[model samples]
Target: MSDRQTSRAGMALALAFFSGMLSSSLPTPLYPVYISLYGFSASQIMAVFGVYAAGVLFALAFTAKVHIRTSLYTRPLYAGLTCVLLSSLLMMFADNFMILILGRFVTGLGSGILMAYINRSLIKLFDTEVSNTAALTASASLILGQAIGPLITGEIVHRGFYALKTPYIILFILVVMSIFGIWRSRLVINRHCTTVTIERKSVGAQSYRGLCFRDVIVCCMAIFLSWAMASTFISQGPTLARSYFNVASVQLVSYSLSAFLLVAGISQIVMRKKHHYSSLKIGVVAQLAAVLLALSSVHTKAPSLLFISVMLEGFAYGAILVGAATIVNMVARQSQQHHLINLLYIVGYVGNWLPFSLSVMMDHFTQETALNAYLILCSILSTCIFLSAYFAVRCQNITGRIRKN
Candidate 1:
């Protein structure tokens, strides 16, 4: 393929990936609507939210062992897009809770496949800096889709439009357009240069084995924690906010969640020049602070404090995501890049799954108390994880010096 053709295909692939992620989170703001309409308990709502993560995990596990031809990314890309389109349609017409859950699960599966492939292709096709740029571009697109879904959905619902169905209808249109773009651009890569060959040249056998100690493990843990915090806020924050602040407006809830995601995307772009480690440190500290503010906001019933916490959480989300991806890029061999990315996502989505337990907690305790306890636990655990990563890196550096001496 020509250079121009490759670039166009690459861009189209990224947009398709974005569309998938957007579809995955499109139902976030509508959880309350569903609860009202269906009389869903907290457990049922969380079940609906967590099912998507389960789909992501299943896709990642299945793809980890397989070697997908880069040239064939478009086939699965469209298939995933079609799945998302079907999911949106199901959500639009669903009268039963089971159907809604099914829609979310399908959306998750579609997003998981597309995200893994897009990240793999971008890293394989480009150089370090170029791939990193592309990765961030794709990540930002994911965040943008996430932000836009809730923001638009809330507006539609608040304005008394088709409410639950309008968001999916609009999403249906976007997916169709994305599919056409991928088809028209002929988004295929050169299969002759496989990721496996690149991996062999990038890292030797011993260095590859040592990945468990240095970069991949730590980055994965950081990503897990980051996504845990983020998913809690995105998936459950609206429910908690309504319970605490008597927030009845869907638009406000949507704006609040979108603000967190928008800040995350913008912060990543603005601080694109910083080192990954530095970003991780700053992000962890911000998350700790956000947790404290979140606790205070719940106690005092202060929206202002909650807003501050949201912004801090955004910083944390952006930093950890970029940091984790950069670390994997720095440490993994070329061939392992795609698989490692998939693994990292798997870990991250596990965090998303963790918040679902709050439904059980809320059953026994007040909403404020249960949420506060969860936030505190996450903060303390995140700090410990950060410290562990720090000491591990320090020990590795010391061992390196001893070997040199």
Candidate 2:
């Protein structure tokens, strides 16, 4: 392929990846709508929300690790299109709660598989100079798709469109367009690259043998904290919005989410172009600010305040993920690429996955009490991550000194 041709195909592949991700979270704002449409209580809605994560987890365990299937990624742009079509059709049957849950699970499955494939594919498409650029694009695509998915759906729903099935109808069209995108672009199916190696090189073989103590406890807490706090709005936002502020429409909540995602997506471009430290420093500051805003919303009970806080948190979350992924991707060896990718996503997804479940568990508590408890737990976790990064930095400094000595 010519240089220009390869670049074009790569970008198209990224676009395809981005669209698939949108389907993963498109149902976010509509959970309340589904609950009302099918007469499900909060617990049932939470259970259904958790089911999407479960589907992804099962795919990660079984499907993602297989070597043979990956050769089909560009072609399975077909599979993604097919799944989106079926998942959308499934939503048409979502007159009941069970169908809503079923459609979401299938939707999650399609997107989850696509996520791993896209990350790996983009990494291969570019050299190191533009590797981070590709990663940023991948990251931005994720932020954009997830951010926009609900907003678009919400707008259609706000306009008196089909209530339960409307988002799916809209999404069906996007997926179809993405299929055409696949056709217009020449996608190379590289047969040589197979599945992620079970054993990573360069990192001590012993290190690979077991999850280190720090990995299990400290790192786990850091992930949980970052994710729960970041995604708190997803599970509770709909109910909370409905109860206190009289925020009835799902589309509006979707917009609230889009606001944050939009900021994150736009900032990524700025980060790519400028490549400055100010953004990194500001991202840390944003995390601190997000915590404060979250606490403030708890006191004011102003839904607007809470929504703003969620957006700020989303921005910080994006920055943190981008920074961390850059560090990991650099530090990990060539053969270890997929493992790093898998582990990072596993942590990131856990943030979304477990937090929703926890919000449900905490629903039995009073709203104020639940918010306080969740905030406190997450705060501790965030502090721990900052400290870990600090020590890791210090450790690197000391190692450098010793080597010089």
Candidate 3:
């Protein structure tokens, strides 16, 4: 393929990725709406949101190896897109909590399958080693889609349109457009011609030797902490905004969530040229600052502080995610990239469920107490990530000097 063709294909894949992620979070701002419509408790609504993670985990477990064995990226892409389309239909017509849960679970499945292949597909299509450009493209697409979904949905719903149905309808159309784009890019037909065969010569065993287990653990922890914070905001931020800040407008709440994620994506773009360890350090500091800001926002009920905290959280999320992904790409061999990436996501997805589990605490404790507990947990995790990353960087520098000597 020519350079132009490859770039076009990459864009098409990015759209598909973006659309998938957008669908995953499309219902975020609508959780309160669901509670009002269905007369469900907050915990029940959180359960609906949390089930999506379960679907993602299931899809990752089964579909992570499909592309390696068949060398057909388009097949899984088609399957994932089909799942997203089905999910939209379910969500559009959903009238009950069960239907919402089912819709989100299916959305999770589609996202999981897409996430498993999209990065590797970009690397293969660009015909390059795992590079920062590819990492940025993949990370930025995922975060931006997540950021934009809620804003669009919230705006439409706030306008008193078909609040529940219209957003999913838009999602369905976006998925259809992405499917067409992927086909037009010839990724569908080219799947048959391009065969990526992993040699069966214990490459996996050798791959482990080159990787630093400590670094891998830190990367996984970084993503886990990042997503944990992001998911908490998405699932519960609106309620908090309305209750604490008296920001009663759904559109305003959506704006706050979107602002957080938008900064995250933008931060990744800004730090794309920086070293991975440096990015991690910046992310750690931002996370700690955000945590402090969050506690203060809750205490004073300051809307401005809440917004600032949200943005800081976003910056931390983006920097940590990009840094972790780039480090994984740098350390893992080509053949084992998917396995390691899948593992990383598995850990991160687990974090998606962490906030919802706090619903149990909210049942027994005051909202302030439960939230403070969660924030404290985030602070501890941030510190651990900082220390681990610092040590890993020191170890790498020492090894480099030894090699030179």
What's the TM-score of each model vs. the native?
A: 0.83, 0.78, 0.86
True-structure RMSD for candidate 2: 5.6
Clashing pairs in 1: 199-335
Find the 10 residues in a row with the least total lDDT in model 3.
199-208
- On residues 132-238, what C-alpha lDDT tens digit does candidate 1 reach at each position? 56557667777887777766776787797889888888889888988887887753543444445455456432222333435677777777877887887876777
Number of the predicted model whose TM-score against the real structure is largest = 3
What's model 3's TM-score? 0.86
Encode model 2's per-residue lDDT on 1-405: one tens digit a residue.
467766776777667667777777677667767666667897787777777777666555554466544355565456656666788889767777787788878877766666666666666554352236656867777777776776776666678677567777777887777777666653453433432244334333322232223322333344455566657776567667787557889678866766767766766666554322233434555676777777777778777777777878777766655554444443333444355555666666777764554465566887777777766666666666666655644554565566557
Q: 353-388, model 3: which lDDT tens digit per residue? A: 778666677778888888788788777878777788
Q: Output the better candidate (2/3) by TM-score.
A: 3
> Model 3: runs farther than 4 Å from truth?
32-44, 65-70, 96-98, 187-211, 241-253, 296-306, 334-337
- After superposing candidate 2 on the true structure, give the runs of residues whose Cα lies further than 4 Å from its correct spot: 32-37, 68-78, 164-166, 183-224, 238-256, 273-285, 296-308, 331-333, 353-365, 397-405
**Number of the candidate with higher lDDT, 1 or 2:** 1
How much is the lDDT of residue 206 in candidate 1?
A: 24
User: What overall lDDT goes with each candidate model?
Assistant: 0.74, 0.62, 0.78
C-alpha-based local distance difference test score of model 3: 0.78
Error in Å for residue 339 of model 3: 1.5
